[model samples]
Target: MMELQKASNGIFHDAAVEGGIPPEEEKFLQHKDDGSKRPEFTDFEGKTSFGMSVFNLSNAIMGSGILGLSYAMSNTGIVLFLILLTCIACLSCYSIHLLLRSAGVIGIRAYEQLGLRAFGQPGKILAAIVITLHNIGAMSSYLFIVKYELPLVIQAFLGLTSASEDWFMNGNYLIIIVTICIILPLATMKHLGYLGYTSGFSLSCMVFFLSAVIYKKFNISCPLETYGNHSVSTVTSDDTCTPKYFTVNQETAYTIPILAFAFVCHPEVLPIYTELRNPTKRRMQNIGNVSILGMFTMYFFTAIFGYLTFFGYTEAELLHTYSKVNPLDKLILCVRLAVLVAVTLTVPVVLFPIRRALLQLLFPGKSFHWVRHIAIAVCLLFAVNLLVIFVPNIRDIFGISGATTAPTLIFILPGLFYIRIVPKTQEPMSSRPKIQAACFSALGFIFMIMSLTFIGIDWMSGEMRSLGGH
Candidate 1:
């Protein structure tokens, strides 16, 4: 290990001599504070203030999931959606708090650390695979959204016709596109610390999308029957003889997974925490509260308004509703364009960490060339698979993500690791706090099992059943 470190340092020095850090920070420059303090006090950019941290957290949680939430709500009803959203929030806070506290005490970085801390190398490998798999589904879904939507936004803005898909058919060309899209922004980023500004821009775009939808719905008519109740839309069309609306039972249960995906964002939190202005439990809690509350409001309004507008007519891609609006007001058009831009920005935020983790695993040394090539290859493979093999069903995506990976990453590993590895004194001290942590861990474990069971069963069955057709 020491010899490997010496060799890595030689390469780093040579790179530092050749080129400066991309645009953000100087490449291969070491901070004076790095070795002096603990690894927790490593060279984290001091960019995350209290408000900014919350916003970063909120943006991380509120990506492509928001687009499909109303449909999920349509499957489940208003009251149940609210109930599930609350449950998801509670479960999310539980994991964040427990994990943050564990990190504070034990200095864990990756989820693999949690597993290794509890079990051993086997545990580390298991956690890494599960989390990586979950992220793959998530990253693929985001890439598909960007690939399909971005070209339209570009055409709309530039007033050009849509381009043909001939180029993407070539694997090398597709990889080149995916690689450039991902690497341009990420390669420039010195660390995750500086992502706050990008997240802020994304948050503004999200706010615009929400406000535009609300404005569009401000004057629309609704039946007296539909006014007070939070129910799914029930409209029939000539294309489909039958109109489908959610039965309350299915709607409520369906929100369980939707909310699970919405609030499921722990992978980015730890790295962000290291950059906090003041890394304390209180600071973390404050960030969680403000950020999640903002998200709830944004998601709640979008769900209600989206359901009100499209109702039974909603498609697998909910954004398709924008094109159907008769007037297609300039304001809505601008907002749609903005949303497309924001989502394009959002996909890279998630992709960077996954790519980074893989690089660390494969190269184990600072080979930027190797890292870039791997990133390009993975993104291209993902783009091709999504375009060819996968159907854009949010339920299927959620089920696959939640069932196979979410449980292991969010609940099982955290709970088990905390209980087993982080030893607690049998002595009488702070009983209430201990009890609370134990309870939270227990609930996380239960949710983990449910996610695994539901997702696992769905994958086995291979059916996409919705309230309307199935």
Candidate 2:
């Protein structure tokens, strides 16, 4: 098996660079064109600056996945969760480094193009499939947040009772209204670079969310000591909050994959790279590093504060936890609105890569068409809305999407492409780069296997619980 794998690697390496400039010389060439015509409808050389690019990429990295961190911490506890999150962030940075380096050496901007260069048709198709799955799942998660959280925000603002049956209070009706009003218009934009302002606003909203979590951590009283005290309100029990530092169990397997999913911005990486001003490996690497570092800090604080606030009782969606704890808290309500706006703006950013992947797969060599772009965007939003309406369990979607697609895109593909494109002549098989690539690929494979196993176990347990309930 090892001999066959080695032979396969050599074949891919040889085929990947057959017509391209040599690896060492490729980086030195001023312009390494792929000989493809530029799209007439969309300008490839966008004027996105270093700071704006960081904001856009940071927005992409931090999405609905952040909402589940408290729940993830509930499983792994504070210490292990932090350690795992740090390791995943490091791996994510390294994977982006490999991608940027490979793309720079080859002068290929699009992810599908990189895949084509690395492993031919199959590689291109695989990239498209993963991008499609991952982005669709991401968009669905954003819409899921909208569908569930939006109604409560409305109710809190209006002082509507749970018994209210008004059409305006209906979650389905509200999601549809918001989708048409907000998401559709944004998703129709041609270039991602134009959405930089919206991305920045979305990121700011998330900052407010983290702030609210931190404030509530100290303000909200714990309910444990007054569990059976009829006179004490759970929301204002006056009990001191206690935070767990470390714990582990079968559920720890699930936490890693969730953290892995939280950092997945790979599909958007190449697109952002293509648009970056003064595009180069080093500049793009800096963009990725700054963005990941910012997000890493945000995720760490959000998870720590949120977990500290709720400890053992953190729900899968932190917003839901907040709503259940204190529906009338003005600050919590504002946090909900901020998150709603953030996720609503984020749908389009996530949508761009999926649309690009579809165009690359189905309309290869064709220039961007407005009709096709609008049609694809509409169809994708429609599909995502349907899933959000029907799929009540966000964690299940998060698990499946993270387990199946996140690792492949974040770790496996980038590592393999780095090894394939950089020839042994340039970076020997026993070199540091190859060793790191091997370790990265191994990590991805391990995460992939563990995620799948955990998903299967959860599914069976859920079914048994359902059967017993019946």
Candidate 3:
């Protein structure tokens, strides 16, 4: 019986094999560039450790959006926010591990490659589209942020209120920020290998911002004000009601998902894994564990502090939440200005992978130094910024960014890859579930529905508001 079982296993193993491709050579098949082409990871020069890898992950995870998370959580109440955070953090750990495990099996360096390995050509194409859409949406949101906020800084400096309304319309400032701050640094990088330092710098800015917020909240005794007309009203025996927890409802729930979406950075994990020093399964797990915990801490604090500072009075526009929080104090204002600049600088770092992935997807055979790819990326980024400046709508941005793209990239794909690739034996040890893949896919589907629904609702709301002249 043992001999029969061994023979059956042998046949199955051989059946799984393809042609004469050894396991080592099959790693290259993950790239599947027809042998005439090679991937960037083919010549990987590793310098990352578990600590540095966590730092990079944390930095990428903590981007410009951390500022807005608390405002989103404000209406939801602290308890609700904490619940969501806990759920997402645990989900993040499982999903990240699954992604890393997928990468290890196929030696794939990007999320798209992982899809290709598991699901073939169609899967690759779909993954590429999801990532591209995600990048476009995220970059557009960042552009809108710069368009709205940077002009205020300039206006304050010039002491001119007249220049404000025309800022996004002109778009030249947006162009400058996109080109000089984002495109140029990314373009000049001889290799993506050295961007870890930039990641380090970005993480430093995150720390600085958190510290500044904490200092202000502790030193100052400012209490939060009420937010929105609908803010939490309760009925009394006299038929009068008081507001509770700032009038949170389903309509105001848009910010909650958007906040979750903004905090995610799963797509960026692939590069860090490839860059790891030993690049072992153990090291990867360690990095994932520490990074998620670190980011959760960072985000939790940022949310709490932002909530404390603005309290229930926080604006729907997250940045304004900061702007209204007694910037008259020079120390606080300086910190605010510093954080803004830091986020502005870090914008380019985020742009790197998005640009690289888009370029590689379209031109798989092309080398990293291909000038045409750079030109195309630059052109597209330029056009995106232009559109963002001219047509800035927070609801539309969130619909595309958080509701549609974030869930697929973060939760859905990881879960799918785990089910597809990870063995059941390994799964039990790792503590990830086979059923989670289905659940994650379902979550992705729900997110897609939510995305479309949000888009429709936003449009309807806008029309009604136009009629009402809010």
* All models, RMSD in angstroms: 9.1, 8.4, 9.2
Give lDDT per model, in order.
0.56, 0.75, 0.59
TM-score of candidate 2 on Cα atoms, chains taken together: 0.85
Better of 1 and 2 by lDDT: 2
State every prediction's TM-score relative to the real structure.
0.72, 0.85, 0.77
Summarize candidate 1's per-residue lDDT along 24-82 as a digit string, tens digits.
12111122222234333222224458877776777677767787776776766567677
Best by lDDT: 2
Candidate 2 lDDT over 113-228, as tens digits, reads: 67876887788888899899888877877777777778778888888756378888778888899889988998898777778899999999999999999988887665623322
Residue pairs that clash (backbone atoms under 3 angstroms), model 1? 21-26, 21-27, 75-251, 76-251
TM-score for candidate 1: 0.72
Backbone clashes in model 3, listed as residue pairs: 231-247, 232-243, 232-244, 232-247, 234-241
- Give per-residue CA lDDT, model 3, range 322-344, as digits (tens): 55544334554555556555655
Off by over 4 Å in 3: 1-45, 49-52, 159-171, 219-248, 325-329, 365-367, 370-373, 392-398, 423-432, 463-470
Q: Which 10-residue window in model 1 sums to the lowest lDDT?
A: 12-21
Instruction: Quote the positional error of residue 155 for candidate 3 in Å.
Output: 2.4
